[model samples]
Target: MLIGVNYHYIRPWYDEPYPGIHGITPEVFEHQLKLLGRVGHFVGAAEIGEALAGVRPLPDRAFVVTLDDGLREQYEHAWPILRRLGVPAIFFVNTAAIAERRVLGVHKIHLVRAWQPPEKLLERLGQSGRSGNGGQMGALSDVSLIESIRRRAAAHYNYDDPETACLKYLLNFVLEPAVRDRLITECFEEMNPGAESEISQRLYMSGEELRILSDMGCLGSHGDDHLPLGLLTPVEVQREIERSVERIEAWTGRRPEALSYPYGSAEACAPPVSGIATDLGIRFAFTVERAGNPDLRAPLHLARCDCNDLPGGKAACWEADRLFEEIPRREWYLDEHVA
Candidate 1:
């Protein structure tokens, strides 16, 4: 069985007044790494891919640490702790941030939220004319759809407050992309004028840093534009994955074989997405589905647990007694769409 732990935003201090961006500090990260070391063997990024491809057998209780978003704080803070502990982990990056030298819209939302509370952010959304009582995106009027989004949001962002969760759901999944992008951009610029380039540079790892990680086989693709691939058309999804893989190879001189889907949600990792990854020669892909993978039978849809749900985290939910429970050998996700 494999336990994939996912992380984002590792920094020394999360000192924003509202502090929308949240993650474990270096001290907590190191502690968690050391604790995980006690129960499982830490493997490099590619090893898990190989294991899933049946090129090698995975050890019992194998754990893979993955940090998404390519945040520089990951390299500066998490990387050192990982290196000191000889822990091998993957740093999944969004190539657009590096290639275009601009902050991706998803990140813009994070920064804006960090700067303003949900009320203020929601007010901005309301002012957009596309946010009033199910204005254009009909999902707001569909009770079932709203419930579904809420369920997904609650599961994915279990740490967020209700208001914060609702705000994120609306911005990420409800509002139109162009409108959402424009609104977030306006808010981000208002928060930090003329700093998209500067912030993109500061927030993400540099090309040289990426190359170093690539040399260590620790770099993977998160996507090119950071849009939810499952929400896009198959052709668009293919473009996103292909562009990301190509840009990463161009930047690092080594093609990435592993990927952590942007958003990592069921919707984000849905059909044609994994199939596209397979066609692109991606050996394995991860989703934010919260469970330990019992086998590599469904390699591309491998499940991952959030760091908060594991030991030494702020909100640990893993069942201690079931650590070595018998894993059924059934394949649960092998639809025709999976390739």
Candidate 2:
């Protein structure tokens, strides 16, 4: 059986009480690596595939490391550390973000960080409305104002743009560049200091960086647009999958036979629509949902444990072992005939 851990960011000043905010801290990450080294063989996604195929011996304790979002922090922080530890990990990147060199759906996060009172930010966002343009701020019912801001922010940041229309309008009317930059950064830090610069640099992996990581046996596709599968039409899902595969293939000369679902779950992994992997000739696919190792029969719906969910950074190593052991017992019960 193969155990895997999913990671995104690694925080520096990880307070144990916080568990590094979202998940493990860089300190905890280091600790986890050390623990994993003692207990298991740290394999990459490809090696895990080979072992599951019975082409290689499954180590007494084998686990794979996988990361999503392809954040710059992964490049700036996790990559060097993983290299130093000599552990191979997979990073999944969305094609559009990298190609465009901008982050989608993050300016609000930045604005929230920069603005004074949360109320003020909300007011500015409310004034912006659904259009990216600043419109007339009539007497908006509270719900209307809130909804309008959300829609506009999603549109502005959810694609390939950085600055939201409200941000542009605010700058035009009030603040200078230095003050604006400072306010934005300050607000971001106030809201989430750990993610300030990291959020701003949420740019996707460049083609050159992708190649380098691929050459080093890291990097894979998260998807073309990073849209959640269940939310998209079947036709849209197919296009998302195909476009990602084509783009990766064009860059690497080798089609990526593996994929990670945007927000993977049983419903999202269901037949026909979810079977895009098998249809696209993908050999393996991963999900965010917690489950045991792949059943071999359902190679396309492999399970991965998120490291962020683990109690301590190293706790996942134990949890992974327990889950691996239970898979056989669960399979046996399922296969047993009932009286």
Candidate 3:
């Protein structure tokens, strides 16, 4: 079985501390990569197909690394480390955000920060019927309200068709760094920005950076505005899939055959999306679900382990490696007993 690692958020030492203690610092990331290189076969996405097809030898301790939300940090921080270690990974990006040059769902957080008296923002959220206090508000946080603002801003831009107006409303008003920082602490526990802003001059991977990463053996795709698939209408979901694939293909000049779902889990991997993957001829699809890799039965529903759980960096990498090691034994037991 092939083990996969999902990573996001790498912070610099000097930046304002993240709101919560969830993101991996650059130092920890370096240690993790080194550990993986030392103990396992860090393979590229391409190698997985070869191994699954029985045309190539799978490494004794094979693993793949993947990132979601093609953040500039991947290029600035993660890319250099991956290059030094000679590890191949995949970066799943939401095309709409990239095209708009703004962050998606997280904008609501920025909007809340920008608008004083957090109560007003909460009021807007309540009006939208998407926010409630925990159970009452239905998991809507100050962050969710910010995300709603971003969606509204995007819709306005689409209708107005003016870059300047989009910049004024979406990028300028909601994405200021001070606003982002405040929201991180006040709203959500996690400090990392979920999306980039077109307005702010913050760092993100440039087109050239993307090209270099692709050339260096990193695959790319759509995490689709980071929405849970179960919540969207069928047409909306299709649009998300098509738009993401189209953007990546246009940028990379290679149609991506692999996709990773946002907030993906076994329960979220319904037949509709799986059928979409099959129709698109995608070779692989991934989820955030924690399980052993499927044995060619459903390549589209590959499971992965989130690296965020590993606070020990290199030690954590080893822990992930250990989990992969358990797969075969568990499979053997299941086959022998259950079958």
Clashing pairs in 3: 72-205, 103-195, 103-196, 107-146, 108-146, 108-147, 109-146, 132-137, 133-137
Clashes of 1: 0
Candidates sorted by TM-score, descending order?
1, 3, 2
Against the true structure, candidate 1 has what lDDT? 0.83
Residue by residue across 139-213, what tens digits does model 1's lDDT show?
A: 355788768878877866778987788788888877778778877887788779887898899989999999999
Residue by residue across 1-339, what tens digits does model 2's lDDT show? 566678876657433321112434677777677765665678886786686578976565567788887666677678888999999898887776565544433333334533344356545545443343333333334676546655554543232223344443333222333334444545555666576345445545567777878777676778876655645677878898888878887887767767888655444444454466568867777765555563444566666766744424543434534545553211211222200
Q: What tens-digit string does per-residue lDDT give for candidate 3 at 223-321?
A: 455555544566766777777777766777776777887656443455477667657657777776555563545667776766653324432433644
Candidate 1: the clashing residue pairs are: none
**C-alpha lDDT of candidate 3 relative to the true structure:** 0.58
| Per-residue lDDT value at 173 in model 2 | 27
Better model by lDDT: candidate 1 vs candidate 2: 1
lDDT of 2: 0.59
lDDT of each: 0.83, 0.59, 0.58
